[model samples]
Target: MRSRRAGRTTGPHLRPRLRRHPRPRRSRGTGTRTRTRTRPHTAVLTAVLLLLAGPAGCSGPGARPPADGSAPDAGSRSPSAATGGEDGAGHWRPKPGTPWQWQLSGRVDTSVDVPVYDIDGFENDAETVDRLHADGRKVICYINAGAWEDFRPDRDDFPRAVRGRGNGWPGERWLDIRRTAVLRPLMARRMDMCRDKGFDAVEPDLMDGYLNRTGFPLTARHQLAYNRMLAELAHERGLAVGLKNDLPQIPELVGSFDFAVNEECAEFGECAALTPFVEQDKAVFHAEYALDPDDYCAESERLRLSSLRKKLSLDAWRRPCP
Candidate 1:
């Protein structure tokens, strides 16, 4: 199985010292749902609105919503938009063979000169985004929408009531996605940070948490709602969002997300689930860690996916599909 990091890195003060070890994997087994015990709707609206207001002096051309009250679809014709965002609204439709770089360990390796860069959202700063943009690259902010890490700067903001069983990850727990009144605002703030940092799109991780024993009675509907809210939030911020490895929901979520990012789908024989994105002319950035590059390159090329053989750590070492 391919290993992957499961948490988001926060600010400098909150960033944990990098530990030298194999990447963390999701734990197996079922556990009781442990909801954070708190008032469901407390301080939600005010906090979200306050965050929506751009941070002082950091506003850009697209900072505010358009006067018509309808946000620009990412697929709209905006120079700053991603591939699928040819429409004025911030919709995303990345095409096949899109070049991309994915890094999730330590500090971001911004030196790579790829057209699309996927970096840690909380650890990266506005300057990093600016630098990538200066180099004519589109940046994708990496956020963890499915699990909660104890090291996040906003860790205190998450009431213990919403945290469920541990996600087999150290210091990380599964969140009850059904609690829209709570998770939505938190996720909104994360999205706002991505916007503030000038990311053109977002790649939210741990999206497949619902398939595990999350300790909540979370059904498919709950996951769908949460995922949809995530995409909507990214769109509202004029940022394109990709659907990370939630394969089972591809049929339902393909239209909602601007693109798709998958890990080891070829190994599991589930790559077919991602055909909708390609059929729609949306990019699917796929990666596999366990397979030999030569073995999968031909298949990946046949599918026209921008695939790569990567280490579980997702370092700068990348072998792209031919």
Candidate 2:
């Protein structure tokens, strides 16, 4: 089980490709249905009013991911150094409370009414992105960052030594994040694919490796360094990046990331951990698979988060916090 997103009643963070990790229905074991990931919505999104009137500023060289065993240092390499976003070269930074649509399964549904759309980076091609943009939506590319799935096209690229135990779901394993030197280039290439496809931002899932029971000796610092380097890579490609499901490190990381994507934070009583993004006037894009929008929408509004209700399959249907 990758987590709840990985399987029903289990891990819930990874955004598997077109086909989801299958789980048995009406499980006698847990009295639960199979669960799918409500992928983190991303895009270098801005307010719709501003976006349609102007083009995004995602053009030019930005920052590079730090070398192996390094963290994003304030003095040496901060996200702002490469982005300095007020300038035209940096990518678009989403404003607080930006509206979005997240759909990761079924046929591409472009009919949803939202300014931003987060979809599978590989499953959906450049045409899908162009269609969304023509309809006036910013697109975010979703990729699983911290875990490796056997089904992915790049699965063979990862050496077996770096692959840890399966993460709740079959065919998915937690990666040894300590190997930043190896992951940085792979991740960068993926981010480059997103940029080349015309995506405005990238959402990297399963980023909370430190908190998971992966079969590796990962520390908080290891996670921080790796996550920071991800942000730098996104910025370097002129793509905004969202911090997915890694709530504990929000304070230390909010400045480095462009936005936040979380799952069931409200259900787990951890929504408060995401306020740093809100306080910074950045969008906190959140979703709940099991909770009714009524249960959390009001509080989400108060916190200035763009909260929505999604099924585990993360299809086109969504209930936004009104």
Candidate 3:
């Protein structure tokens, strides 16, 4: 999420750690489940929801159908809790409307009272994760899953052959995700670190590297394969995984991931693209670095998003929607 290198200009990746100048203050910026509900109640609720649903299902309450007009899979809605159904493997599934604190820079201020915390996986250790657990919070380990950062401790682990063009941010380059033979073991170790450190989940950044100019002839199919592999690796360690900023593939990936971490969808008029996750009763941890709460909170709430107003640095400071 950051580079210790001096004078690196921030790039427009999903979350930029630093910018040459602060963005002008204004509006704009950017899962799956098991069934927990009783059948009869679910039936009545489903029927009522369908009766109320309209073509503009993107901005309102209740279940949102896919563009093909198919209903979401059945699951008990737990809007009041951040926790979701635990699969047999004991992976943590965060539900829609879950509150969270995402801090990727500086010493994480664990003082924030929230149900979940997303912190740099390499920066924080097992002790920090234990503290969060003691305080009744789910800790998410953040790592660069699809990109190679020059500053990371395991920078040398990545072979130069897999490195692609710079991913906007200094000292970071997109990884050739298609080469799973090399990446699988490398990313597996990162996921193992999250599980070993007691993290409940993983927030893998740059998941949409295929969509960017990575100097690799990556396609959507390549992205899907790599992202699914990431999810499998996390789940293998009994840790939940999030799809970070890969909107185009949500319909296909919402089932593989336990939740999602997004940035600035509201600003780019792309929030509607995220409805698939919400429809599945999964958490959508969203942040807006530029938009005020008043600008998007209402729609965010209706769509069951866990919305926050954060600085580009993504420090401990946050303005959570009430």
Candidate 4:
């Protein structure tokens, strides 16, 4: 798992920190479903909207397991895999109050009985996505969009000129978002991989690089442009896009993104800032590392945010708001 946007420098890097001590993969077991209010009306609205928006992107053909500790080979795949997204118009739009599980570390425990699952885009293969879809779950692909990691298969594709200072994570550096001409194709490839893997949505991490001490003269305008570009990429691939922790710009970006992914908003007294998304009927998938579910479940329920208590490592364990 990656760090929170607010505590980027201090939040733990779950994978890099445990590279040598990887936890053993656990077999999929039946997950206990959290009791949530069924919103039959909302589901109907979403389905109607999807139909009006045209067909969803096609799932990638066949299940080719990704290599151990690396991304799948994009070179051997057909260019059509990256070309399904026509005009960035029709895409999945998850509504407010949707329950979800975010697991980015260790092997994904797919038994979680929620209607949604968010997992790393590179770590898991097409087979995992197929299984999730088989179980009638919407899968969100997690990608490090605002930063460059040395461990990715396409690491060398990023030029040194675009790499900035470390974002408090090991072997990870912030990318210069202003360099769109250079970064556009790279990010498109990542989104392409997500679409090709049959993901329904995407949660791009570290989107608020401008607010951090990145070694670049980034402005809020630059951040907005880059984030909007990311949303377009996902939509072009016919996948839902999320605004990850850039709360201050929610009012401006709510229309561009399909949903929002937040970290520790309740702890920071910023949960209200995400209301624009909910008010627009978009989901806000949130998590807290330090606070117990008891500390904020009431507020979470009151606000109708999809909130949960998760360990800093962000493994399978989770305590959802009741």
Candidate with top lDDT is 3
Ranking by TM-score: 3, 2, 4, 1
Question: For residues 1-322, could you state the per-residue lDDT of candidate 1 as single tens digits?
Answer: 1123435342111111111121333222332212111111224323432433312111112122234533222211222434444545745456766867777666666665457778888777899889888877788998878778787787888889889987544577788988989989999999999999888998887676566677898776788999999999999998899998665667789878888887766654455566677877888898765565555555666666777666555656565653
Q: Write the per-residue lDDT of candidate 3 for residues 34-82, one digit (tens) a residue.
A: 1110112234324434443522222322232244533232222222354
lDDT of 1 at 107: 64
Better of 1 and 3 by lDDT: 3
Tens digits of per-residue lDDT, candidate 2, 1-322, equal 1222322343233333211324343232343443333222122112321333322221122222233412231111111222213224566777667777777765667876667778888667899999988877788898878888876778799889889966655577889999988898889888989999999999987787666567998887999999999999999988988998665567689889888987776665556667778777778888776565566776776776777766565766666665
Off by over 4 Å in 3: 1-14, 17-82
- What range of 10 consecutive residues in model 1 has the weakest lDDT sum? 11-20
RMSD of 4: 14.4
What local distance difference test score does each model get? 0.65, 0.68, 0.71, 0.69
lDDT score of residue 181 within candidate 3? 98
The digit string of per-residue lDDT tens for model 4 on 39-146 reads: 113343245335334221111122222224222322121211211122236677776777788887777887776777888888878999999888777899999888
On a 0 to 1 TM-score scale, where does candidate 3 land against the true structure? 0.78
What's the true lDDT of residue 165 in model 1? 85
Q: What is the C-alpha RMSD of each candidate to the true structure, in Å?
A: 15.3, 14.3, 11.6, 14.4
- Over the full model, what C-alpha lDDT does candidate 2 score relative to the true structure? 0.68
Alpha-carbon runs more than 4 Å astray in model 1: 1-85
